[model samples]
Target: MEERVPVPPPHPAQDVTEHVGYRLKRAAAALRGAMDRALREHDLTVPQYSCLELLDEQPGLSNAALARGTFVTRQSANVVLRGLEDAGLIVRAAHAEHGRALPVHLTPAGRQRLHAARGAVYAIETRMIEAVPAERLPALLADLDTMAAALDA
Candidate 1:
């Protein structure tokens, strides 16, 4: 009788980490780390910064809208908003027409913090994009836009 031999499981034909999604996830994680470090001086987390930025851009935005813009659930948005309020960085005002909705507004202190964070955020972003040549930026942005559009669709 022929001796039987065990064969190890075959590895995947391709490196999963080389896929677009994997690469994007890895890049996002790295970017998040940089952002976290940059925001540390301001005592803000990524979610908190996002909340402040959104409120600064669109004053009196409802919690629902803020959640949508920040890509978080309403409950998660509320948590961030509460933290900001506790930090005296934001205030919630009753909506004019919607009894159930409240609009989030940045306080003067919040605006100041946001302003201080701007420079750090910009520096981090600059360093991140500096890895690619300036001429390639447009192409990279276009690719990102296309990807975003595809995901939206």
Candidate 2:
């Protein structure tokens, strides 16, 4: 005998633009496009910049960790790391000491590039921040964190 799970009844439909998820996606796309343009001037992509930023902060993250932090696939992170290597922006161990994953570190050039890229990215961030009320910024940021946590949970 098969037992069927009850399906919840559909709720009333609304315009996508009025929905939170739609707005989030739209906002994300705009931010990504703006970041792409800003980073392009520095000859770096968002994922590459993100990897460098993480490497700068932690200094020895594996490609998998970088990919996870950047919300990318491991293969994509590998490609980004290779590109950075080709640009003399980062280095990896010749062999892993404990596992198959090689830890990544930013070179001096990567630090320099990150310095410039940070300014551009911060400008974009500042623009977004300014759009919201200063008094509400903390609550807004916290709400965003809560939303992400809900999804993660």
Candidate 3:
């Protein structure tokens, strides 16, 4: 038998390092890290904090609405709500008209925690964006809006 020759794989022609999806993923991961660090002081996970923020903003949001806003499943929302309730951070009351539905409200303690966490979040965000020039933020936000609109469309 003739000796076999080793063949190398062909290299791709275009640079794939800066693909849109990869950039988006990297940015999302970085943002998530900042948020996680900011919320850690309050003993809140990202999901828990997100749920609390939603409840704080909308006093009587239904579990379904909370889940929708937080991009979590109904079951996951229920779990988080239960934890918040156990922590004395939220109260769940039966809906006035919808017998099958439960409305979530932030307790006073929850409000205080959320207020404190908000400050931390703002500080974290400020630090995260400080490296960028102030003039670039409006454009960056606008680009994000444009991307969102395109995705929605």
Candidate 4:
């Protein structure tokens, strides 16, 4: 008779706090808190900062695109854009060059503000990366991407 091998049981969390999702949420909350404090010094909110970063890389993005890139709702993005416009940080075209998607552009002042805030944001990210070992940084990023993809699917 052939010998049979037993299957191992699946790993389980001992408590809710021990779950991977819970840990991820805790880390995200901490990061958000740190970013909030850091950005406040530059007179920016997290969503506004995210929008600025996106626009810096890809100028002339529409409201919907900005909303998706910033992980905010279209209505929320409109509000953010309005606030930025009022602050002289960004300008939306009066008429759409094509279709109804009015393009957004960063003003000189907007670029300057973003440049000023980038350092503090980068510092926070640097601190986060420093917490992990140098060799494991790639794996950590990949793991995060995998987790997000799993949920997206």
Query: Which predicted model would earn the best TM-score?
Result: 4
**137 Cα displacement, candidate 1 (Å):** 1.2
Q: How do the candidates rank by lDDT, highest first?
A: 4, 2, 1, 3
Rank by TM-score (best first): 4, 2, 1, 3
Model 4 poorest ten-residue lDDT run: 6-15
Give the alpha-carbon lDDT of every model: 0.89, 0.93, 0.83, 0.94
Worst 10 residues of 1 by lDDT: 6-15
Tens-digit per-residue lDDT, 70-98, candidate 4? 98999999999998999999999999999
Residue range 78-148, candidate 1, lDDT tens digits: 89899999999999975555667787889999999999998998898899899999999999999989998
Winner by lDDT: 4
lDDT per residue as tens, model 3, 22-141: 678887898889889878888887788888888877888888898989889999988988888999999988555566777788999999888888888888778878977999999988
Angstrom error of the Cα, residue 31, model 3: value is 1.9
**Which residue pairs clash within candidate 1?**
none
RMSD of 4: 6.4
Global local distance difference test of model 3: 0.83
